[model samples]
Each structure stands twice: as structure tokens, then as C-alpha cells.
Target: MARETWGTRIGFILAAVGSAIGLGNIWRFPFQVSQEGGAAFMVMYLAFIILIGFPAMLAEFVVGRKTELNTVGAIRDFAGGYWQYLGGLFVFIGFVILSYYSVIGGWVLRYILGSVTGGYAATESAAAYFGMVATGTDTLIAHAVFMLLVIGIVALGIQQGIELGVKVMVPAILAIFGILAVYAFTLPGAGEAYAYYLSPDIGYIMQNWQSLVPAAAGQGFFTLSLGMGVMITYASYLGDDKNLGIDGISIVVLNTSVSILTGLVVFPILFSAGVDPATSGPGAIFVSIAEAVLDLPFGRVVGLLFFLTVAIAALSSAISLIEVVVSYAIDEFGMDRVKATVIAGVAIFILGVPVTMNTVFINLYDILAAQILLVLGGVLLMVLVSWLHAGEAIEELEQGIGDLGSIGSLWIWMVRVPVILVLLVSLYLGVTGYIDFLTGAFAEYLGTL
Candidate 1:
């Protein structure tokens, strides 16, 4: 059987951008910036996206185009030794992400229901409702339902299903998010939200440079879907019909715009409503933001739109994640996409139970999976492309890159040695103390009352 290619280059770009623009960009990005250093945090995050995220993206393109296999097979065929370990790392990271991501996807479904049902009218009532959703079996059922939707789509195969799915959802997501952002701009205290968001605290970041490094890098990596097999898989479907260089920049721009707009909608509402944006840990994005939205005029209707858009973004991204693991199964085990999808989805569903049942565990899983693995993945990708396969990879990357020589030896080498070690050490600290610091604060907040 031959591998599937995307129907159109535009369809492929939209799907790739959809995969990149997930709830992490919306909820996670804003909250992380607020916690790290606000405007200063945004500066670092943007910098990393350009430096690390863009190159890693081209590297994945090199691997996918060269091997025409999924992550597992790519590494196995390419390195022929420990290279397959890289692919295994890809599979592992995707599986871990799916476990918790679908749980949040469920929350999106619940909020979708609320939009129609007026789920949150009064500020106080909205807070209580959020608590119920966060700590309820309701979330479990929603997670299962969302996972099923993802599996059903992947079961339809890549061209007939995944590409078509993103083509529809990505546009709707943008439309709805645009409407919500317009509405947000009209709200009382929206200006304060803008002020709170735009005002960069350089002093805070300078004093806390240690914490900002990994926080900004990890968030940047996850936001662009770099340092993951998603980019590799998306690139594997690419044809030479379009300029890879131009399309790569477009995807990054679209993803970054949605993330920035998400902040526009969220932080303003939080500042106006007096809810601490950082109060809920990683979960804070949903819980705290929902609480703030409940206080706006016709707040329930707004909450409905917010969560519904969130659900769409989450589901779209979740599909790519499941595909990453399932593609490995199909590529290596000869399992059909349907069986592969079911096997991976069901397995992750069971593993996700811990995160679902225990809110604390769910938060911990979100932090560690993203903070440690994401940065680690990005660093390794930089080393591999910038050095391990530099001579060959750069050639492939530069085919349409215009001038390959401009990247310079020192420039590429920078990502290979110092940059790699820095991200690795950041990963180590993020997995240990930082987890305790962030989660512990979150747990303390949850424990109150």
C-alpha cells in the first residue's frame, strides 16, 4: 500500500497549522506568560519560536522527506542504531500528551454544552460550576467522548478524514475566536486587560531569569508543535508543489496569531473580573478564565463560545497526536489505521484515567509532559539536524530556503552544543523542583476551602 498525500497544499498547511494551534496556545500560553514575566515572558517566548522552533520544523521536513516514514521508522532507517530511539521518544511524547490533552478536550465539550445551556450566568455561580466540572465524573465522560471522536476521524484515513477535518474546523475556530475577541474588546475593563497583558515587567524577569528560561522555551516549543513528531508526520505528506520555506513561515504566523489573540480574550477578562490568572496552575487557564468570563455581560453566552472554540482547537490537535502514535503502529506493525487508532486511543484512554480522576494528577501530568519532554525534544532535534545530519539536512532544508550559506557554521553549531545542553538542563530542573513549585502553589490554591 502506498502512503497517503494531502489533497491540496493549502489543505495540508491548514491541517498543520491546526495541529500547531491547540489549547496550549490559547489557555496555556497566556497563563504561562503571566506566571513567568508577562510582556518580558512574551519576548523570550517569541524569540525561541524563531530561533529554535523554525529550524526544528525544517529538520522534521528533512526527516519526513528523506525517509517518507513516520517518526519510529524514520529514526530506525536513518540512524540504523540508536536513531530509532529518537522515534520511540516521539511516540512516547505523543502518547503522554494525548493522555492529558483529551481530558481537557472533555472540558471543552462540557463548556460547549454550557454555551447552549447558559452554563455560567452569575460570576459566583460560574465559579461553582467550574469547580463542579473540574472535580466531577462529568469530565471523564467528556474525555472519553472526545477521544472517540478523534479515533473515528483517524479511522477514516488521512486524506479522506484528517485533512478534511482540519479544513473545516480550523476556519470555524478562527471565525468563532475572532467573534469572541471582538466581543471581548467591547467589555468593561477590557482596557485594563490590555494594559495588564501589554505591560512588560523587565525587572521581574531580570530578577527571576532562572525560572524564565525553560518556561519560555517549553511554551514556545509546544505552541508551534515543534520538538514533536506532529511536524514530521505533517511534512511526510508534503509534495514539492509548494515552497516549503514560505509555507513554514505561514504556518508559524497563523499559529502565533491565534495564540496572541487567545491572550487578548483571556487576560483582559481575568484582570477585569479580579481572578488571578495564575491561581489554578496549568488547569488555571480553564478554571480561572471561565470564572472571569462569567462576569461579563451575557457572560454565559460568552463562556459557551470560549469553551466551544477551545474544544474545537483541542480536538483538532488531539487528532494529530493520536495519529502520531497510531501512525507508528501502522508503519511498524502493519496494523491498519483503524485498528492502530483504536489500539492507541484506548490505551491512552486507560492511562488518562489517573489524570481524569484526580485533578492534582491531571495538572502534574500536563506540566511534566510539556515542560520536560517538549524542551528535551526540541533540543535533541536541533542537535540532530544542526549537527548529526547538518551536512545533508541543511541541503534538504535549503533546497527552497533561498540561501543556505547565510545560516553560517557558527549559527547552526550554536543550537548543536550550547543550546542543546541548556535545554536539557532546563528539562531536568523543570521535571523536578519547578514541577513542585508550580503544582504545589496550585495544590495549595485548590486546597483552600
Candidate 2:
């Protein structure tokens, strides 16, 4: 069977953007901004996305379009002997990420139902309501349902399944987000929320660079869907003569736009309700928004739209993560697409059991996959593409756009020196910071008990 290619250029772009915009942007970004000095985190995140994230994205595109293969095949074919193991690590990263990611996908699904029925609206405390539903039986059922949805889509192959799905999903996501943003801006505290989200605190960043930089860097990688084979796998479906650079910039811009838009929707609501944004972590969206919406006009209708948008966004991204590993199975082993998808989905669902059973495992897997492993993957892949296969990478990059000249040299330089150095530093800080974070969290939990 011939390898599946994207049906159209726009299809590919939407799908790639869909992959980049996910729960990381919608759920995690707001909390991260609140915790990491608000606008200081925003500044650093945008810098990393433009400076480090773009070049790394192009590098992944080069490898994928050059080989027209999954990450494992791309690395193995380009750099023979022992290098394929590196490719396997990326696939593993995707699997691990999706394992926990689907659990959150489950949460989004539950919230969607909660929005429809006003189930959470009757609760005295949104935090307590979230605590009740975030784990155990309800979450396990939600996780299974979400994982099954992902499997059904991927099993249909690229053009029919992933491409067709994202084409509809991405647009709906953008439209709903736009509606929500406009409504949020009309809130009384919108100006204050904007100041909190957009105003920079340089001193806070300087004082807390150790934790902030790594967290921002990790958020950059996580939100952009970098440091995993998702981009590589998405690009593998591309036809020739496509400009990887321009497409990459488009993805980055759209992804960042949505991240900012999510803040527009979230922060205004929180500030208007006089809720503290920093107090909520993973459940920030649920608790803060749930509480805020109860006091707003047509709050249930707005809540439904918001959670509906989140559901679509989560599905779009989950499709890409599963595709990374499913493509590997089909490409390397010549397994049938449907079979590969089912097997991959089942394995990921099983892996997600612990995450659904205990919410603590959610933080554990998130830090392990998003913060630590992702930055580590970025470091290794950057070195592999920019250093090990410099000539081939440049040649592939220059295909759609003629003769990069100074541009090509600069990209390699960015990837080699600063990108690698920054990721390595982030990885180190992430490891130590996560340790302290975990320790403190544990002691705090014990004290409460």
C-alpha cells in the first residue's frame, strides 16, 4: 500500500495547528502564567517559541518530508546504526504523553457534559466538585471513552480519519474561542485581568529565573507540540514543494494566538469573579471558570460553549499524539493501519489507568513527560538534525524555498548553540525544581491529612 499523504495544503496546515493547540494551551497555560510571574512567563514563552521552537520545528519538518517516513524510519534511514533508538525514544515520549493526556481529555469530556446539564453549577464549591470527579470510577470511564474516540479516528488512516477530523474540528475550535474572547472582554474586570496577564514583572523573573525559565521552556515545547514525533509524523504526510519554514511559522503563530485567546477567555472571568488565579492548578479551568460563569448572564450557555471548544481542541491534539505511535507501528512493522491504531490505543488506555485512579499520577506523568522528557528530546533531536546530518537537513529545508543562504546557516546556528544550551539548562533546572515541587507537595498533602 502506498503511504497516505495529506489531501490538500490547507488540510495539512489545520491538522498541524490542531496538534499544536491542545489542553496544554487551554488548561495548563493560564495556570502556568499565573504561577510563573504572569507576563514574565508570557514574555519568556513567546521568546522561546519564536527563537527556539521555530527552528526545532523546521528541523523536524526537514526530517519528515525528506524521508516521508515516521520518526523511527526517518532517523534510521538517514543515520544508520544505533541512531534509530533515538527515534524510538521520541515514539515512547508520544505514548507517555498521550497516556496522561487522554486522562485530561477525559476531564474535558466530563466538563462538556457538566456544562450541558448544569451538574457542577449546583455544587457549593467548584474545587470540591472537581475533586470528586477528577479521579476513580468516573474518570476511568471518561478516559476509556476519550481513548476510544481517538482510536476510531486514527484507525481510518490519514486522509480519511485525521485530516477530515481536524478540518472540521480546528475551525470550530477557533470560532468558539473567538466568541468566548469577545464575551470575556465585556466583563467588568477584563482590564485588570489583561494587566495581570500582559504586564511583565522583570524583577520577579530575575529573582526566580531558576524555576521560571525551565517552566516557560517546557511550556513552549509542550504547547507547540515540539520535542515529540507529532510534528515529524504530521509532516511525513506532506507532498513535495511545500515551504516548511512558512508552514512552521503559521503553526507557531496560530498556536500562540489561541494560547493568548484562552487567557483572554479565562483571566477576565476569574478576575471579574474576584477569584485568585494562582490558587488553582490543573483544575484551574474547571474551578475558576465554573465559579465565574455562575455569576454571569447566560452563564450556562457560555459555559457549554467554552467546554465544547475544549472538547474539540482536546480531540484534535489527541489525534496527533496517537498518530505518532500508530504511524511508527505501521511504518516499521508493516502492520495494518486499523490494527496498529487499536493496539496503540489499548496500550495507552491501560497506561492511563493509574492517572485516572489517582490525580497525583497526573502531575507525576505530566512533569516526567512534558517538563523533563520533552526538553531532553528537544536537546537530542536538535543535535541530531543540526549536527549529525547538517548537509542533508539544509538540502531538505531549501527544497520548497530556494537557497536559504544566510537563513539556513542562522537556523543551524540557533539550533546548535542556543537551543541546545537553553534546553539543557531547562532540563537540569526542571529536574531539580520538579524534585523540590514534588517533595513540598507531598509534605503539604501529609499535613492536610
Clashes of 1: 1
- Candidate 2, residue 257: the lDDT equals 98
Alpha-carbon runs more than 4 Å astray in model 2: 441-449
lDDT string for model 2 (1-449, tens) is: 89999999988999989988988898789889988888888999999899989998998898889888998998888787888887898899888889988998888888888888888887778887788778989999999999999999999988899999999998899999999999999999999999989998889878988878898899999988888888888888887799999899899999999999999999998899898988746777788888888888888998899888888888998999999999999999999999999999999999999988877887888888888999988898899998999988999999888999999999999999999999999999999988987999889899999
The stretch of ten residues in a row with the least summed lDDT in candidate 1 is 118-127
Against the true structure, candidate 1 reaches a TM-score of 0.92
Highest lDDT scorer: 2
lDDT of 1 by residue, 1-449 (tens): 88888888888788888888887787678778778767778777777777666656766777776677898887676567776787888888888888888887887787777667666443356557667666557778888998999999889988888988999889988998899889879877788777667777788778876778778778877877766688887777776545666787888889988988888888777877887765646567767766776667777777878887888888788888888898889888999888899999999888887777777776566666677877777776677777777787766665555565766455467667766776786688677755676877778888995
List ranges where model 1 is wrong by over 4 Å.
122-124, 400-403, 408-411, 417-422, 432-449
For model 1 the local lDDT of residue 329 reads 90
| Index of the highest-TM-score prediction | 2
